[model samples]
Target: MSLRTLAVVGTGLIGTSVALAARRQGVTVYLSDRDESAARTAEDLGAGRAAPPPEPVDLAVVAVPPSLVAPVLAESQARRLALSYTDVASVKSRTEREILATAPDPTRYVGSHPMAGREWSGPRAARAELFRERTWVLTPTRLTSKRAFDRTLDLIALCGAVPRVMGARAHDEAVALTSHAPHLVASLMAARLRDGSAEAAHLAGQGLRDVTRIARGDSRLWSDILESNAAAVAEILTRLQEDLTGVLAALHDLASPGPAVPGGTGPGGGGVVPVPGRHALVDLLDRGIAGVGGLDGAGGGRRGAPGRPEAPAFPVAGGR
Candidate 1:
């Protein structure tokens, strides 16, 4: 059955976006937020009504930060706010564990994360088509009731997202590699530009802009995300550090002087010299090109590539 009604517990970007999308599909949405003004803003934007529903909703979406998901879901469940509950927080394992421990009816809850959003946040940044063609991960435990799972899938469908079911631990680890770690890497790279020379800043082009786009996100919220998924994020960052050390060493070698090339004219007619680590530099560049090419057109992984598994289709509720 289609989702007829939903109650969004936090009217931030994701929450408001969900409400807007559901409202577009003729679903009744009730918006609420701890910051009452935010909820009102969403209501004014035509996402939904700011007032509480007269009866329990079909689903309740807790679209808060990872740290708040458990408590908020528990409270909503205790109040009988909805027949089913789901959260749109990035990290899943910690929130799932907390829900199991604290929620009044853990069987009614499912964990979800929409692989969508802009760097800009708040209810004002929301749009009904924000989730179109995007991945919406559903992490359902063995204790999740079939009815609740199906209702969550109906919510995903209404939002125009493809659903993919995974275990909470697996989802956490996957996102840490793809999303969480990348955000930290982007922020660290962007941090270097803060004290850069004016000329350097002026010469910046789309490459730097693209890499640092997500660095403009809310730091407090990102801090909570990093903390919640620290272990998985740390593992990925450690591997990145190892790669960085090798690249730095290669760059140093490339900058060092080497034996002069016979009969070669250098700049200003001086004898030309070869740089050390030419082979290493070339290899690194080649690898970078290959890695980037792999990410293009096929999303992240290359399909049918040797030693790489084909990308899995987004799983629907009962079947795809």
Candidate 2:
């Protein structure tokens, strides 16, 4: 099924970006948010009109927080707000569970997460091309109707994001590793700067800036996200803690004086030898390099995919 009209709930960064992208593709869009001013801002930016559609829309895109997804979807479905519904929340398993329990028509809903965003938030930060070449995951259960799922695929195509399908639980666990846990790690590292002296602050370089860039995200939003996916994030943090302990042990060895060399003969005779666990530090650094290189090619930059089509044109209404 093709998407002609879309109703976007929550006119924040992701929501407004979806509306703007859809509108740019000639799909009529309606915008709404708890913050009326935000909706107005998105509307002013050519995303969509800040009003509910006169009739049921082809699809309703819920772009609210993970915890609010089920309630918002239930309300939208009850009002017949759209012929089909989908959400752009980060955690899918929890949202899907709530939808099955609370929504009037769970079959009409599919859970999705668009793996794209900027450090900034709100409509002002929204961009029509924010999702181009990005991975947008769709987590559809057996209960999801074919018609609803197809409509969501069309919406993802319009947004120029490559669609990847995964089970709800898998999606949650994947994001916990790639995003949720890393966010907390960044925040923890950035927090250390809070007590730095003037000289230390002045000596800060790009490495510190790069590592903590994501720490600038809205704290309340991140807190909610972390709480929703607590189990998965906790598991990743546990593994990270193990690695950190090893690294700390290696650092302690490096800081302590090593045993003197047996052959006491040259100038300053027995200079302290290299630390015994130096290999551990080198191995850790090597693993970090490999991990970063792996992420660089993670997408493989494939073409002709759902959201990465070559020669993409404006989607024709009622046409695939």
Candidate 3:
């Protein structure tokens, strides 16, 4: 089958990036976005033509917010805009459920999440290489057609993303701890700076920058993401809270200098006679800070670095 065109129903960062990538591969694209100006902008950038379906396309990519994925797919399928559909929503379970509950036949659709993004957003932030080398998840139910699956996977490969297959629930659960929870934690921490002292804000460095990067994402989009994976995110947050409490308790002991602070004991000499949890927490945090500094293949404390005395070579993941 000679596939010629793709219908991109959203023109935000991911959508525009998809258009740019597909067009670069010599595929024709049809563009649509609620924001007319944004849609026009993407077209002007040579992403695609700002036109509705001149004829039913092979695949439709609904690259809207997490909340709109299902509804948009249902409406698009209902109107017969594309023979098959897929989405680029970050969270997958709720959207998949919504698709099953709404679409006439969910078989014509696939739920996908690309594990890639940037702190910046919108069409201007769109880059054809956005998904390069990233893992793109495809959650296809038993009802999904082979044609749809093949077509969607083709698009994923064309985008330079490696396809990882998993159930929708598994996808959502994994991203909850790895992506969603981290975003919430970052936002909550950045919230502290809403009224923080100027000196503190100015002195902020990569530590705060890395943590708060996702905090700058579209709040409305994240609200939808957090809600969809609330159960899993809640579980992760509970564990994180437990860790945070440990860190705080440790700080309290040292700040007030319970009783000379040695021997891993607290004020009442009841801290932790052996294997102190507080001291362990401090050591873990120190290790984490040091490990992060070793990012970019650069090592610190060449003599006594926490992670490994000797650097593990550059780009451990890709052998860069």
Between candidates 1 and 3, the lDDT winner:
1
TM match of model 2 to true structure: 0.87
Model 2 poorest ten-residue lDDT run: 311-320
- Candidate 3 backbone collisions, by pair: none
| Candidate 2 wrongly placed segments (more than 4 Å) | 257-274, 300-320
Q: What are the per-residue Cα lDDT tens digits for candidate 3 across 7-76?
A: 9999999999999999999999999998999999999999999999778898999999888898888889
In candidate 1, how many Å is residue 207 off?
Answer: 1.0
Candidates in order, TM-scores: namely: 0.87, 0.87, 0.83
Off by over 4 Å in 1: 257-276, 299-320
Model 1 over residues 117-229: C-alpha lDDT tens digits?
Answer: 78888999998988886789999977899988999999999888889988999999988977899899999999999899998989999999989999999999899999999
**Rank order (by lDDT, best first):** 2, 1, 3
- CA lDDT, every model vs. true structure: 0.87, 0.88, 0.82
Q: lDDT score of model 1?
A: 0.87
